[model samples]
Target chain A: MNEKKLKSILEKIHDKNYDCMILTQFNNIRYISNYAPTSFAICLLKDDPIILTSSMDKELAEKTSEIPVEEFKSFNELKKLFEKDNFKKIAIESSISISLFRKIEGNWDLNIEDFLEKERMIKSKDEITKLEKAAGISHKSFKELNPMKKREDGFTEWELAYELGYLLRKNGAEKESFETIIATGTNSSLPHARTQNKKLQTPILMDWGCKAEGYCSDTTRTFVYSEKQEEIFDIVFEAHNKAIKSVKAGIKSCEIDKIARSIISEYGYEKNFIHSTGHSLGLDIHEIPSISKKDETILEKNMVITIEPGIYLEGNFGVRIEDTIIVGKNKAEIIGNLPYSI
Target chain B: MNEKKLKSILEKIHDKNYDCMILTQFNNIRYISNYAPTSFAICLLKDDPIILTSSMDKELAEKTSEIPVEEFKSFNELKKLFEKDNFKKIAIESSISISLFRKIEGNWDLNIEDFLEKERMIKSKDEITKLEKAAGISHKSFKELNPMKKREDGFTEWELAYELGYLLRKNGAEKESFETIIATGTNSSLPHARTQNKKLQTPILMDWGCKAEGYCSDTTRTFVYSEKQEEIFDIVFEAHNKAIKSVKAGIKSCEIDKIARSIISEYGYEKNFIHSTGHSLGLDIHEIPSISKKDETILEKNMVITIEPGIYLEGNFGVRIEDTIIVGKNKAEIIGNLPYSI
Candidate 1:
């Protein structure tokens, strides 16, 4: 599987006339070499890619990396090797820090590209299986938590969030993909409110995910009680449903965002609908081809994305609904069978 | 406290003759504004520092930020604001991505500095209070876990790590400072080994920390059984003790590292000790002035650091002992009352 992935990346490097691609992002390195670095490490991708890791990571790298591993000494040593190999142009990840970029920009043309992200946008059958498993575990854990009961029992926002995390881990998730957001009542008006110690309130918005085999699953559900809250929830549910339904191979991602935005706009809550419709996910919780107004990346089969639409009424309350979906030839397949409503 | 922090940053900006210092790092923003952004945000440090946060973060930012908050529209809008303000020179954090640097690089002087890190190295009284509380909770929870009994019960490495995480949160930690490292038997030889599903084995090495009030506390302990393992553990403990004892205000951090390295080297395991002696800690787990051979940063009063030394024998096992300490005029004060020997 990695060989095919490497082949595509190599073809891109060759097309760009670059000698090699330097990947410092942990996920990118893991995608290419299967060695997820715990500390600083670099993956130099070429015909025969090699991972240069710290001395402390040499043992783990040797054990896990499919590609060859070597101990990284210093940039000076790496520069000497590049000079010896007569390398000139090299592709680099855009996430590289400017300080590190300056250290290696001496005698080479450093062309920044999102080659790994572009490659990762299209998941393989194995990748989709991992995502499905992650989604399954997350949904199963959420069901086990029974948020409805917890809310009735007067659980604090943090307690509910912590319980969900415990359930996720117990059900085989390595950990949460990101910090779980559990906003309640007026706090829900803030899209990314920190889980507070206050008791559960009328409306509860939870956006959470967990990782299974390095793949991430993200989903959000808002439980509402008041009539007004339910009204907003229904609008967000409509946007979420339409957005996911619009996903298909060969369509622009922005179009899906437009579909969701238009529905909320028609309800006169366009300004209240903050944030992107959704984002792609894999090893990392957030990836390229974000479902927003600006991204124009064409959707492709095997791509996994989320369709999350939210309506936040500042100082009052908010509602959001989300699900992970796999792009299909003519439609979209939701990853898990979790119910959209409470 | 935030006002004081902002004042210091603005003074530095004025001294450099820069119009503003753009901070993208979450910790820097939190340090200067008391608002930790959940999404993308920027802190523009000037006479009247302001934070530009995403629409999703505007509510939370408004509620938490000590400085004024504004909704960020786009990078082009920001460029126009800078042009309108006649800003010519700007300072940026070293961690800013090269791509972001490029976006705002045109017709302006961008100077990279570690101003925030330097300021953060010296902890305030309130910061120390938070760190001490974090350490107290971490040590108490470690005691509660009773790893000695967990080993007898034959728990898996990951299970033990998970249990510790549960204890930390239950004891009032926001979360783990980093992923808990619970490497048993030969796996412990890897300094940053991921917790595995394998049953417990001899020489269990556990490195863990927790966050309290946004501050972090880090500590490591190894449980050894065999005589050979005890010998290695003793050497590591000696190095750890001497390193902590040598810390004081006005000494270079490298001197403390040398004290620890020389002790380990005398045991003829210099090569076995692969990583630095220690590192500073605060809101972020790893801070500045790493206690390594090359770092000549002068230690100052109120600076909190860790003194951790380890010996890793490939294909065998590893032993590490760590403790967080506060630099004093004459000596270092270890934070928690946890015993060195378990």
Candidate 2:
């Protein structure tokens, strides 16, 4: 399984004329090696890749890493290990810190290239299975928590978020993909508002997710009680439904954004749609090929992404609907069976 | 207050002949502009500074920022704005991604510098107050949770972490400084162990903290059961105590590390003491001038840091003690009143 993930990256590195690729992003390293480093560990993707970790991480690394693990001593020693092999010109992740890049630079020519993100853009059957399973757990937990039914329970936003979190774990999620967002009332206008201690209000915007086997699931739903809130919610729901229907292999990511944006625009609320249509999610929540007006990557089969459309009316209220989907041979397969409206 | 924070960085930028400094790290930006970006945003520090944020964030930015806020467009447009000002060079954080650096490179000489970090190393009276408050709340919450007494209860590690999190929020914390680590028995051997769902064991290790107005406080306590665990705990406690007593404004960071490390070495378990002595913390959990053997930074007044010393017996169990402190004129001032031997 690890060999299959590494094959394409090796070919890419060879084409780019680099001897090896260095990966430091935790999720990227986890993609290549089963080990998700709890601390600093360097994954050098060579013909025979190795993970160099600190003494503190050695035991965990040796236990979990699919490849050979070595205890790191110093940069000088690390440089010597590579020099003995007469290596030159390395590809590094775009996320490498300048300090790390500098320490590893003097011995060889180093350039930042994201071979892993590109390779990860196309998901395998195993990866898709994890995403689907994560989505199922998240959806089931949402149903169990039933935010709409508990709307008037006098719970603070944080309390509701805690309840949902407990549900996610009890239903078999490893952890939440991100901190749960339980923005209510006027606070929902902020696209990425932090969960507050304020009481539940007329309109509540919940954006939450859970993880399964390192894969992530993201979802959002707004419970509306007033006529004005419902009117805005319907517009977002239409944009979301139409955008998912338009998704297919060969269509550019921006096309999906355009379809979603156009629906909101037709409703004369384009300016109120604060963020991108959505983004890709797998090991990490925000991955390559964001579904935004500026992103142009073509959709491909088995690439899982989300379609979240929101309309925020600043101090009044906001409404958003989100769902994860799998890019299919011809159409998008929405991941869960949650009701659109309550 | 923000002006006081920006003065040093502006001088450093001018000394290096750079037109301005570009900051993207959320805390660094917040340190200067008082607006922490939820999504992507750029802060330009100059004679007259401004924060360039997404339209989605413009509302919040305008509300919170001490400096002027503007809508960010493409990098191409940003280049034109700087070109109009006759800017020739700029300083950036080491954290700037290779992709972002390349996008902003065509017109200006971009270099990674740590002026903000060097400046943030010393906390202000206001920052110290927040840190102290954060530590107070965290300590009070731990007392309320009382892991020692809860050891016999049928609670999972995750459950303890959740209960502690609830207590932190209820006791006036904005949120946890980081995810609470609740490692029980053998799991505690991993320095950075994740909280598990397994039932609580005899010896419980919890490293936790909470945020007070964006400043962070970190503390760790290991609840030991058997005499073997208690014996290891005393060694760690002695190391933690002596290393902290050695903290003064004039000494080097490495000296403090050496003091703790030497005591652990004397106990014939130097190899068991796995990570660093400690690290500085403020807006971010880990900051500049780490209390490690390699760090030669001279301790300075008002520098807030942690002194956490531990000994792990690989597959058996682990014992650790940590405390946040303020480097004083001639001694160290531990932030919280939490009992050491509890």
Over the full model, what C-alpha lDDT does candidate 1 score relative to the true structure? 0.91
- In model 2, which residue pairs have backbone atoms overlapping below 3 Å? none
Docking class of 2: medium
Mark the regions of model 2 whose C-alpha exceeds 4 Å error after superposition: none
Residues forming the 10-long window of minimal summed lDDT in candidate 2 chain B: B1-10
User: Which residue pairs in model 1 clash with each other?
Assistant: none
Worst 10 residues of 1 chain A by lDDT: A1-10
Give the lDDT of residue A64 in candidate 1.
Answer: 90
Q: What is the DockQ of each candidate?
A: 0.83, 0.66
Q: Model 2: per-residue lDDT, tens digit, B62-146?
A: 9899999999998988899889998999898988877777788866788888899999999999999999999999999999997
Candidate 2 chain A, which ten residues in sequence have the lowest lDDT sum?
Answer: A98-107
